[model samples]
Target: MARTSGDDMSAGATTPAARAEALIRRYFEACNAADRAGLIDCFTPDAVHYFPPGLPSAPWRSAEAIADGWVWCVKTLGSRWTIEKVLAGADGHEAVIEWTHWKTSVNEVLRGDEWYIFNDDITRIIEIRAYYASPVNKADRVNSLHGFDYAGRGYHLDPPTPDLD
Candidate 1:
């Protein structure tokens, strides 16, 4: 459904964490409804959504792009998502959620966790890093987000060497 209210927050979503959770629920609702505008409203102008390797598009940058991608998935794949759980950080700037994506048309299900970074006020999501619970690709050396700039984003590229006496 299209977003009718400007405020994404529910009535009891007074705290930052609650607001963040509410926004995530709203985002999923938009996705299920194929509401492009509502999906766009959940993210900042330059928000980015990262995906594990294998998907045609690795990362969806910008709110418009992200919205379009999900809308397409719903249309073409008969996609629907269910939020299994959500844990918002105490500070409300970050959250992690477990979800199940059902590709109804293909009769497939994917379980994954997504790490979310919200804007300072917790009203909009700025970044999403998705990790899937799937078997590693034996041929691929690293099963990380395909197009993400790990080093530039300050992610560790190598495991720390062990200190042995």
Candidate 2:
């Protein structure tokens, strides 16, 4: 039996799952290089991205909405975004990715996962969401945009305590 375009992932120049992964890689590469246009190009015009920490109840519903919000975050937050792991679904429609956003000052590091749902043939990302966790710091005020705070008095900032609570 001959394989269809979706069936033989290796045969074609474009496969749904492969394209999604490639687009994802390019997105992060552009982020690392600070290419705003390239970053924006990865999404569909109607794509939605949600910063889970910032808005637990609401999500950025459009590319423009997300871009407007991303401006400030990118300006003050200096970091390299990289995918640590990726698992593409067998259906070639969705993927789960483990990624890291590491910053220099305060040596802040956020480890997270993203779930991507492609719009068509992985060429456009229709829905993307990320969830990450980092240590809490008192000086964290200047270091974070999320406004995280610790309650205890013995709190130390040198090496932030893990979020085991």
Candidate 3:
């Protein structure tokens, strides 16, 4: 069963993990409600949301853009989301969650996992990388987050050379 925003701890007063989880719950509530202001409050001003290839807007850069995109989804697609699980890092700077997005209007659901990078204070999300539960896109040479600077971000670009005797 998926969890709702009101199913868990309050956003204030708790461990880092609880706080992060609460914030995410609140963010999803805002998204389902199509509350633009509320959505914007959950992220840093320069926050970015990365999506897998094939999405019209691959990377939604900036908090405003992210909020706008979600609002659009809710309004157009009757979008609602549920958090299946959340795992916060011990350091509290990072967390990951599994989610299911329901497009009620179209009767479609998308399941995915999102890796979140929180700001130093752990108050707002600075980055989100979404990975969908779908088959690989064979058409794309490199199936990864579109428009993301993987190289600049120091992500592994190529596999290490194998050592064979």
Q: Which lDDT tens digits does candidate 1 get at residues 46-113?
A: 99999988777769999999999999988897777766667887778898886667666655556578
- TM-score of candidate 3 to 2 decimals: 0.77
* Candidates' C-alpha lDDT: 0.76, 0.58, 0.74
Let me know the TM-score candidate 1 reaches against the reference structure. Answer: 0.75
Q: Name the regions of candidate 2 deviating beyond 4 angstroms.
A: 1-13, 55-58, 68-71, 133-165
Model 2: lDDT equals: 0.58
Model 3 C-alpha lDDT versus the unseen true structure: 0.74
**Candidate number of the best TM-score:** 3
Score residue 32 of candidate 3 by CA lDDT: 73
Model 1 misplaced regions, further than 4 Å: 1-9, 136-165
lDDT of 2 by residue, 35-113 (tens): 6677678778888876665554358777666555454445565555546566776555788786656564435756566
2 against 3, candidate with superior TM-score: 3
- As a whole number from 0 to 100, the lDDT of residue 77 in candidate 1 is 76
With candidate 1 superimposed using the best TM-score fit, by how many Å does residue 69's alpha carbon deviate from the native? 0.6
